[model samples]
Target: MANPSHDRDPGLVLGFERTVGDEVQAVARSAGLVVDVVLWMLRRGGWSVGIGCGAVDEPMPASPREAAGPAFVLAREAVEAAKSRQRMVPLAVRGSDEGAALDAEAVLMLVAATGARRSAAGWEAVDAVEEAGGTRQEDVAARLGISQQAVSQRLRTALYDETRAATRAATHLLTTAHP
Candidate 1:
């Protein structure tokens, strides 16, 4: 099988390896999964995987001013790839200090938000809000006289709930369509 890393950009390749290395180490220590072999399997399975900076990298900067150029580049790439439907995982290597951990969390949250938006449920809520003339979360909240946080929370919840419902509906439609 072709290596998923073969055609990927050099920076992305490094990021992937870095992320996978960290996850593998953690999984081995805590979950009993071998880091190397799992990565090998994933690579063979055609997944475009990239690793986030693990905790083992340089200390997290006190502010964005302190972050390394490469670190920011990798984070931006990972976030963009995730937004575009490419699978990106941030790997936090073992021994990463607390600061790095915080940075990793922020990156992962960006990935999750992207994933949520890509979901069918997410699109439905987005569509609904747009149809209702709400151009953005803040706009929606303003119209409803609620906090932006509340609007965000409601959008997320509605997306999840609607996605589940849509999935069921699709399944039923498929079943009946074929029957």
Candidate 2:
């Protein structure tokens, strides 16, 4: 059965589930930025994900008062839309009223591009850089014992810059909300 439960994005309070997929896709997109943060930390490397902003319902107990809300409904609809269109990621945006909204279609395209284009070596390089806290590509190359140029090429081929930029924006949205 589906583990129907309302979960908050870890390290960032939001109504959403984290790591919505298993074993990390080459690219993925989540409707919530906080979910991206979790994905970034958990990804097997070279994987990229986008974040969507919106409201979502947490799974509630037997109490109807705590049931899921419109946000959850909207997110569900977004996922269904993506599936119908064979998009790479699920998207749901609550617009400015909720948070940093993203165009689901755009995110789907970017994510699909990453998944379709990433290579195994590229994934390893990207993962290493991220695990090291976005370290310099030169440093990553040295660690991987490859030419800096090679690392640069891998990152470029994987669309690492664009993917990281999106993830960073999503993270900023989550952090800025608290302080």
Give the best candidate by lDDT.
Answer: 2
Mark the regions of model 1 whose C-alpha exceeds 4 Å error after superposition: 1-98, 106-119, 127-179
Question: What lDDT tens digits, residue by residue, belong to model 2 across residues 1-179?
Answer: 01212443233333433435532211112334344533433243333333323333455333322445554444445444544553334333333334334443354345545645678898888777867786888898899999999999988888887876765555555333222
User: TM-score for every candidate vs. truth?
Assistant: 0.23, 0.56
Clash-forming residue pairs, model 1: 15-51, 16-50, 16-51, 19-51, 52-91, 54-92, 54-93, 55-93, 55-96
Candidate 2's C-alpha runs over 4 A off are 1-9, 12-32, 35-66, 88-105, 168-179
lDDT (10s digit) by residue, model 1, range 54-101: 222356433333345443444445444534563343222211233443
